[model samples]
Target: MNKHETYAWFRVVFIGTACAWLCWRLFFADATGGADIWDRNRETMSIVSYAFVFAMAVFTRPGKGVVADERDRAISAFAAKSALVALSLVVLVSATIIGTEGHADLLTARSNGWFEHYLFACVMFGWWVESAICVFHHWRDRR
Candidate 1:
Protein backbone atom coordinates (compact mmCIF):
# COMPACT_ATOMS: atom_id res chain seq x y z
CA MET A 1 0.00 0.00 0.00
CA ASN A 2 0.95 3.65 -0.43
CA LYS A 3 2.03 6.04 2.32
CA HIS A 4 -1.41 7.68 2.53
CA GLU A 5 -3.12 4.34 3.04
CA THR A 6 -0.57 3.39 5.67
CA TYR A 7 -1.09 6.66 7.50
CA ALA A 8 -4.86 6.30 7.24
CA TRP A 9 -4.73 2.81 8.69
CA PHE A 10 -2.53 3.97 11.54
CA ARG A 11 -4.87 6.85 12.25
CA VAL A 12 -7.90 4.57 12.34
CA VAL A 13 -6.16 2.14 14.69
CA PHE A 14 -4.87 4.93 16.92
CA ILE A 15 -8.30 6.56 17.19
CA GLY A 16 -9.90 3.20 18.00
CA THR A 17 -7.34 2.58 20.70
CA ALA A 18 -7.81 6.09 22.06
CA CYS A 19 -11.57 5.70 22.20
CA ALA A 20 -11.26 2.36 23.96
CA TRP A 21 -8.79 3.85 26.40
CA LEU A 22 -11.06 6.83 26.96
CA CYS A 23 -14.04 4.56 27.69
CA TRP A 24 -11.95 2.53 30.09
CA ARG A 25 -10.58 5.58 31.82
CA LEU A 26 -13.84 7.48 31.98
CA PHE A 27 -16.21 4.73 32.95
CA PHE A 28 -13.95 2.41 34.94
CA ALA A 29 -11.45 4.71 36.58
CA ASP A 30 -13.70 7.69 37.29
CA ALA A 31 -17.04 6.30 38.34
CA THR A 32 -18.28 9.82 38.95
CA GLY A 33 -18.21 10.47 35.14
CA GLY A 34 -17.68 14.22 35.34
CA ALA A 35 -14.91 16.57 34.17
CA ASP A 36 -12.35 14.11 35.45
CA ILE A 37 -13.38 11.70 32.68
CA TRP A 38 -11.43 13.89 30.28
CA ASP A 39 -8.18 13.47 32.12
CA ARG A 40 -4.58 13.43 30.82
CA ASN A 41 -5.16 10.55 28.43
CA ARG A 42 -7.57 12.48 26.24
CA GLU A 43 -5.20 15.41 26.04
CA THR A 44 -2.34 13.09 25.11
CA MET A 45 -4.44 11.47 22.39
CA SER A 46 -5.31 14.84 20.91
CA ILE A 47 -1.67 15.85 20.82
CA VAL A 48 -0.61 12.58 19.28
CA SER A 49 -3.26 12.84 16.54
CA TYR A 50 -2.25 16.38 15.68
CA ALA A 51 1.43 15.49 15.62
CA PHE A 52 0.78 12.56 13.32
CA VAL A 53 -1.22 14.84 11.04
CA PHE A 54 1.74 17.16 10.70
CA ALA A 55 4.10 14.27 10.07
CA MET A 56 1.75 12.87 7.44
CA ALA A 57 1.83 16.18 5.61
CA VAL A 58 5.57 15.89 5.15
CA PHE A 59 5.17 12.85 2.92
CA THR A 60 2.01 14.11 1.20
CA ARG A 61 3.10 16.84 -1.15
CA PRO A 62 5.51 17.86 -3.86
CA GLY A 63 7.63 21.03 -3.48
CA LYS A 64 5.50 23.92 -2.22
CA GLY A 65 3.13 24.44 -5.16
CA VAL A 66 -0.51 25.40 -4.63
CA VAL A 67 -2.07 22.02 -4.03
CA ALA A 68 -5.79 22.59 -4.44
CA ASP A 69 -7.52 23.37 -7.70
CA GLU A 70 -10.47 25.74 -7.84
CA ARG A 71 -12.94 22.92 -7.37
CA ASP A 72 -11.17 21.76 -4.24
CA ARG A 73 -11.14 25.30 -2.91
CA ALA A 74 -14.84 25.74 -3.57
CA ILE A 75 -15.66 22.42 -1.93
CA SER A 76 -13.61 23.32 1.09
CA ALA A 77 -15.29 26.69 1.38
CA PHE A 78 -18.73 25.07 1.36
CA ALA A 79 -17.60 22.51 3.89
CA ALA A 80 -16.32 25.21 6.22
CA LYS A 81 -19.55 27.18 5.89
CA SER A 82 -21.57 24.08 6.76
CA ALA A 83 -19.30 23.33 9.69
CA LEU A 84 -19.77 26.83 11.08
CA VAL A 85 -23.53 26.55 10.76
CA ALA A 86 -23.47 23.24 12.60
CA LEU A 87 -21.31 24.70 15.34
CA SER A 88 -23.69 27.60 15.83
CA LEU A 89 -26.62 25.24 16.04
CA VAL A 90 -24.82 23.09 18.56
CA VAL A 91 -24.05 26.10 20.74
CA LEU A 92 -27.65 27.24 20.55
CA VAL A 93 -28.90 23.79 21.47
CA SER A 94 -26.52 23.58 24.40
CA ALA A 95 -27.62 26.99 25.59
CA THR A 96 -31.27 25.98 25.34
CA ILE A 97 -30.64 22.77 27.25
CA ILE A 98 -28.78 24.60 29.99
CA GLY A 99 -31.55 27.16 30.30
CA THR A 100 -34.29 24.52 30.40
CA GLU A 101 -32.46 22.42 32.96
CA GLY A 102 -31.88 25.17 35.50
CA HIS A 103 -30.20 28.55 36.01
CA ALA A 104 -27.37 30.08 34.00
CA ASP A 105 -25.25 29.37 37.02
CA LEU A 106 -24.96 25.81 35.84
CA LEU A 107 -22.82 27.04 32.97
CA THR A 108 -20.53 29.29 34.94
CA ALA A 109 -17.34 28.30 36.70
CA ARG A 110 -17.79 30.52 39.73
CA SER A 111 -21.36 29.39 40.32
CA ASN A 112 -22.03 26.12 38.52
CA GLY A 113 -19.37 23.36 38.81
CA TRP A 114 -18.76 20.10 36.99
CA PHE A 115 -21.66 20.58 34.61
CA GLU A 116 -19.93 23.64 33.18
CA HIS A 117 -16.82 21.59 32.59
CA TYR A 118 -18.86 18.86 30.95
CA LEU A 119 -20.53 21.37 28.65
CA PHE A 120 -17.22 22.90 27.70
CA ALA A 121 -15.78 19.46 27.00
CA CYS A 122 -18.58 18.71 24.55
CA VAL A 123 -18.00 21.98 22.70
CA MET A 124 -14.27 21.39 22.49
CA PHE A 125 -14.78 17.87 21.20
CA GLY A 126 -17.09 19.12 18.47
CA TRP A 127 -14.63 21.79 17.43
CA TRP A 128 -11.79 19.30 17.41
CA VAL A 129 -13.71 16.89 15.18
CA GLU A 130 -14.58 19.64 12.73
CA SER A 131 -11.01 20.83 12.61
CA ALA A 132 -9.78 17.29 12.07
CA ILE A 133 -12.14 16.78 9.14
CA CYS A 134 -11.01 20.00 7.51
CA VAL A 135 -7.38 19.14 8.03
CA PHE A 136 -7.86 15.68 6.61
CA HIS A 137 -9.54 17.03 3.49
CA HIS A 138 -6.86 19.62 2.98
CA TRP A 139 -4.23 16.95 3.38
CA ARG A 140 -5.95 14.85 0.76
CA ASP A 141 -6.05 17.80 -1.60
CA ARG A 142 -2.35 18.31 -1.18
CA ARG A 143 -1.63 14.67 -1.72
Candidate 2:
Protein backbone atom coordinates (compact mmCIF):
# COMPACT_ATOMS: atom_id res chain seq x y z
CA MET A 1 0.00 0.00 0.00
CA ASN A 2 1.06 3.58 -0.53
CA LYS A 3 2.04 5.88 2.27
CA HIS A 4 -1.31 7.67 2.30
CA GLU A 5 -3.22 4.43 2.63
CA THR A 6 -0.85 3.14 5.27
CA TYR A 7 -1.10 6.32 7.31
CA ALA A 8 -4.87 6.38 7.02
CA TRP A 9 -5.25 2.82 8.16
CA PHE A 10 -2.79 3.38 10.97
CA ARG A 11 -4.77 6.40 12.16
CA VAL A 12 -8.07 4.52 12.05
CA VAL A 13 -6.72 1.56 13.94
CA PHE A 14 -4.77 3.57 16.48
CA ILE A 15 -7.51 6.04 17.26
CA GLY A 16 -10.13 3.31 17.33
CA THR A 17 -8.07 1.34 19.77
CA ALA A 18 -7.55 4.32 22.00
CA CYS A 19 -11.23 5.16 21.95
CA ALA A 20 -12.18 1.59 22.74
CA TRP A 21 -9.71 1.43 25.57
CA LEU A 22 -11.00 4.67 27.00
CA CYS A 23 -14.61 3.54 26.80
CA TRP A 24 -13.71 0.37 28.61
CA ARG A 25 -11.74 2.21 31.23
CA LEU A 26 -14.46 4.76 31.78
CA PHE A 27 -17.60 2.65 31.63
CA PHE A 28 -16.82 -0.99 32.30
CA ALA A 29 -14.05 -0.87 34.85
CA ASP A 30 -16.32 -0.42 37.85
CA ALA A 31 -19.56 -2.01 36.84
CA THR A 32 -20.03 -3.54 40.26
CA GLY A 33 -20.60 -0.23 42.08
CA GLY A 34 -17.15 0.93 42.97
CA ALA A 35 -15.68 4.40 42.61
CA ASP A 36 -17.23 6.59 39.95
CA ILE A 37 -15.31 6.13 36.69
CA TRP A 38 -15.38 9.74 35.62
CA ASP A 39 -14.24 10.96 39.00
CA ARG A 40 -11.35 8.52 39.17
CA ASN A 41 -9.39 8.19 35.94
CA ARG A 42 -10.99 10.53 33.41
CA GLU A 43 -8.25 13.12 33.49
CA THR A 44 -5.47 10.58 33.34
CA MET A 45 -7.05 8.71 30.47
CA SER A 46 -7.62 11.91 28.52
CA ILE A 47 -4.04 13.02 28.95
CA VAL A 48 -2.62 9.64 27.99
CA SER A 49 -4.84 9.30 24.94
CA TYR A 50 -4.00 12.79 23.73
CA ALA A 51 -0.32 12.18 24.27
CA PHE A 52 -0.41 8.91 22.36
CA VAL A 53 -2.14 10.52 19.41
CA PHE A 54 0.28 13.43 19.39
CA ALA A 55 3.26 11.15 19.50
CA MET A 56 1.96 9.00 16.69
CA ALA A 57 1.27 12.06 14.58
CA VAL A 58 4.73 13.47 15.15
CA PHE A 59 6.50 10.22 14.41
CA THR A 60 4.50 9.03 11.41
CA ARG A 61 5.70 11.17 8.52
CA PRO A 62 4.50 10.32 5.03
CA GLY A 63 7.01 8.76 2.68
CA LYS A 64 9.01 11.11 0.52
CA GLY A 65 7.23 10.08 -2.67
CA VAL A 66 3.75 10.73 -1.27
CA VAL A 67 3.39 14.24 -2.57
CA ALA A 68 -0.02 15.85 -2.76
CA ASP A 69 -1.29 16.26 -6.31
CA GLU A 70 -4.51 17.85 -7.45
CA ARG A 71 -6.67 14.84 -6.70
CA ASP A 72 -5.16 14.37 -3.31
CA ARG A 73 -5.66 18.00 -2.50
CA ALA A 74 -9.26 17.83 -3.63
CA ILE A 75 -9.92 14.77 -1.55
CA SER A 76 -8.37 16.39 1.49
CA ALA A 77 -10.43 19.52 1.01
CA PHE A 78 -13.59 17.48 0.71
CA ALA A 79 -12.79 15.51 3.82
CA ALA A 80 -12.03 18.67 5.76
CA LYS A 81 -15.30 20.27 4.67
CA SER A 82 -17.27 17.21 5.62
CA ALA A 83 -15.57 17.04 9.00
CA LEU A 84 -16.25 20.69 9.67
CA VAL A 85 -19.91 20.21 8.86
CA ALA A 86 -20.17 17.23 11.16
CA LEU A 87 -18.39 19.12 13.95
CA SER A 88 -20.64 22.12 13.52
CA LEU A 89 -23.69 19.92 13.82
CA VAL A 90 -22.32 18.36 16.95
CA VAL A 91 -21.63 21.75 18.46
CA LEU A 92 -25.13 22.94 17.62
CA VAL A 93 -26.74 19.91 19.18
CA SER A 94 -24.58 20.16 22.27
CA ALA A 95 -25.32 23.82 22.63
CA THR A 96 -29.02 23.18 22.31
CA ILE A 97 -28.90 20.50 24.94
CA ILE A 98 -27.02 22.72 27.33
CA GLY A 99 -29.19 25.77 26.64
CA THR A 100 -32.62 24.14 26.80
CA GLU A 101 -31.91 22.34 30.01
CA GLY A 102 -33.31 24.19 32.99
CA HIS A 103 -30.19 23.73 35.09
CA ALA A 104 -28.92 27.16 36.06
CA ASP A 105 -25.43 25.85 36.87
CA LEU A 106 -24.86 24.10 33.57
CA LEU A 107 -22.05 26.50 32.74
CA THR A 108 -20.32 25.94 36.03
CA ALA A 109 -17.03 24.05 35.98
CA ARG A 110 -18.35 21.11 37.95
CA SER A 111 -21.53 20.83 35.91
CA ASN A 112 -19.95 21.41 32.51
CA GLY A 113 -17.44 18.62 32.80
CA TRP A 114 -19.61 16.22 30.90
CA PHE A 115 -20.18 18.79 28.21
CA GLU A 116 -16.46 19.19 27.81
CA HIS A 117 -16.11 15.45 27.47
CA TYR A 118 -18.83 15.37 24.84
CA LEU A 119 -17.10 18.09 22.87
CA PHE A 120 -13.82 16.26 23.00
CA ALA A 121 -15.51 13.11 21.75
CA CYS A 122 -17.09 15.09 18.94
CA VAL A 123 -13.74 16.51 17.88
CA MET A 124 -12.12 13.10 17.91
CA PHE A 125 -14.97 11.65 15.90
CA GLY A 126 -14.56 14.44 13.39
CA TRP A 127 -10.88 13.72 13.03
CA TRP A 128 -11.56 10.04 12.54
CA VAL A 129 -14.19 10.75 9.95
CA GLU A 130 -11.85 13.00 8.00
CA SER A 131 -9.14 10.40 7.96
CA ALA A 132 -11.57 7.67 6.97
CA ILE A 133 -12.91 9.77 4.15
CA CYS A 134 -9.45 10.49 2.87
CA VAL A 135 -8.61 6.82 2.97
CA PHE A 136 -11.79 5.89 1.16
CA HIS A 137 -11.20 8.46 -1.54
CA HIS A 138 -7.66 7.28 -2.07
CA TRP A 139 -8.74 3.66 -2.31
CA ARG A 140 -11.56 4.44 -4.66
CA ASP A 141 -9.40 6.58 -6.86
CA ARG A 142 -6.91 3.80 -7.20
CA ARG A 143 -9.57 1.34 -8.23
Per-model TM-score on C-alpha atoms: 0.47, 0.69
lDDT score of model 2?
Answer: 0.68
Which portions of model 2 show Cα errors greater than 4 Å?
20-36, 59-63, 101-112
User: Please, what is the whole-model Cα lDDT of each candidate in the order they appear?
Assistant: 0.53, 0.68
- The numbered model that scores best in TM-score is 2
lDDT of 2 by residue, 78-139 (tens): 99999899889878986786686574453443323344454566777777788788889989
Which ten residues in a row are the worst by lDDT in model 1? 109-118
lDDT per residue (tens digit) for residues 32-95 in model 1: 3444444533466567667866866785675555455675556457656755776678778867
